[model samples]
Target: MTNAAHIRLLTTLEHSLDSGQQVVSLTNDEDPLTLKDRVDRIERIELHFPHFTDGRAYSQAYLLRRRLGFKGDLRATGDVLIDQLIQMKRTGFSSAVLKDGVDPADAQRQFERFPAFYQSDVASETPVLRPGALEKPE
Candidate 1:
């Protein structure tokens, strides 16, 4: 989604809440707006997907990117699937941690199969039908 060489894939993480790192980990129910006051100090935010069907993180990611203007790494953690990578990127996730046994190579291939999308998304505001729409956002 970032048009980077490849999608960032992590095998695991130790939630940063107790470590005092610049990372913030939030559950699906947590409001991203609560972090608005200190978002600048944060370097990365990990949003959890308790279940594959639960998608509250998508809205949270949108708020962090569009409303809060967070430019740091937005990672998807827990129950992440290869099929969800595209939408996750479109919704503002910069990286994802694949569930156990999920092959990163196969996950990366998903992007190669669909290099472009027709509709506008968080990564690109312009629709492909419009001129300069495919240009990756800075």
Candidate 2:
């Protein structure tokens, strides 16, 4: 697996596509640009949270799905924990690269622990909630 920590923006990514640097861009808390702006230009984006306590990356992933409509590969690359994998997939990440010293098998286990469609928006054959509950009270 590639070391995501080594990934960097060699130049203003939007302007330097021809550089062919095999670069992967990451966004931290100070990024002024929106997820849409970043994803629109780059082929891949890694969402980086300096610590597990910081959750801004989750919101960024949510926006990438629900707002930005980014369809390319989205990855979680810093301070990642196995417990977060399910939630990360729910937020639209396709893959995750764990922090240094974490086992790759553990990361693979995170991907396989849940079914592919788990927590997705696929419609069910039967509604678990009563239809009446879905309607406003008159």
Candidate 3:
């Protein structure tokens, strides 16, 4: 919205639809597609996780991707951690803002730890078999 001459800010879901705003900021508990008829207007989604333990953001991301079919930027904000990066990507987060003082290289290694996975995620909505695949959980 920076490049646009006018930026429309809507506080609530109803206000957004009522005002015809394209951008939205959602709390973890709030569904991104509140106004189903105007879902296409959503250009970006920012999921706020108050704490690592508060993983409602993850569910919100999944709903946006699989249910709402949101193709816009799904960003993770607040209390993010290196360990949650892969899961974030799997669920549909396009990018994340990390905490200060965290090493980017070391954090990247966390994603490398798992060469493949069995669960169907946003990256691969259907599970696929890859070489050296981990045994399916019993």
Candidate 4:
């Protein structure tokens, strides 16, 4: 799970993005592979959720991280919820803008509840929660 500073909760999108930043807003249907050539030039990519039930952005984020190897910020926008933050981080979202009415502190608590996991994710190739898993046996 990401720290409070890592996963930002924005009450609104207005003025959230910095001017002159190399940002790309990709719809759920867009293919992240299309940006492979320009990944290095990009600084941030915003993936939209559209509706709370729509999860295509997750795949998009994964592709951006695992396939395209984008190291820049991966932000989640629109219809984001506190419950989705855990999976969002696992899939490679560096930040999220919480939807209206969601408490930022509550979102922080969610990360606190599950600080690590046993599954391999985009950020790490091996299970992180297991003791000594990161070290090779002699």
Q: Give lDDT tens digits, candidate 1, residues 81-133.
A: 99999889889998888887877778888888877778888888876678775
Which residue pairs clash in candidate 4? none
Winner by lDDT: 1
The residue-level lDDT of candidate 3 at 95 comes to 61
Candidate 4 global lDDT: 0.83
User: How well is each residue in 1-138 modelled by candidate 3, as lDDT tens digits?
Assistant: 111111121223323344323657788778666846665668777788889999999988888888878877676777878788788888888766666655556656666687567777787766666555677767
Q: What local lDDT does model 4 show for residue 102?
A: 76
lDDT of 4 by residue, 22-96 (tens): 999999999999999999999889999999899999999999998888998888999998889889988999888
lDDT of each: 0.84, 0.57, 0.68, 0.83
Q: How does residue 93 of candidate 4 score in lDDT?
A: 91
- State the weakest 10-residue window (summed lDDT) of model 2: 5-14
Model 2, 1-138: lDDT tens per residue?
332322111122222343333335557664424444555566656688778888888777777656766766666766777677667766767656665566655555654555445223311233355457579878
Rank order (by lDDT, best first): 1, 4, 3, 2
Scored against the true structure, residue 47 in model 4 reaches a CA lDDT of 99
User: Model 4, which residues run further than 4 Å from truth?
Assistant: 1-6, 13-17, 129-138
TM-score of 4: 0.84
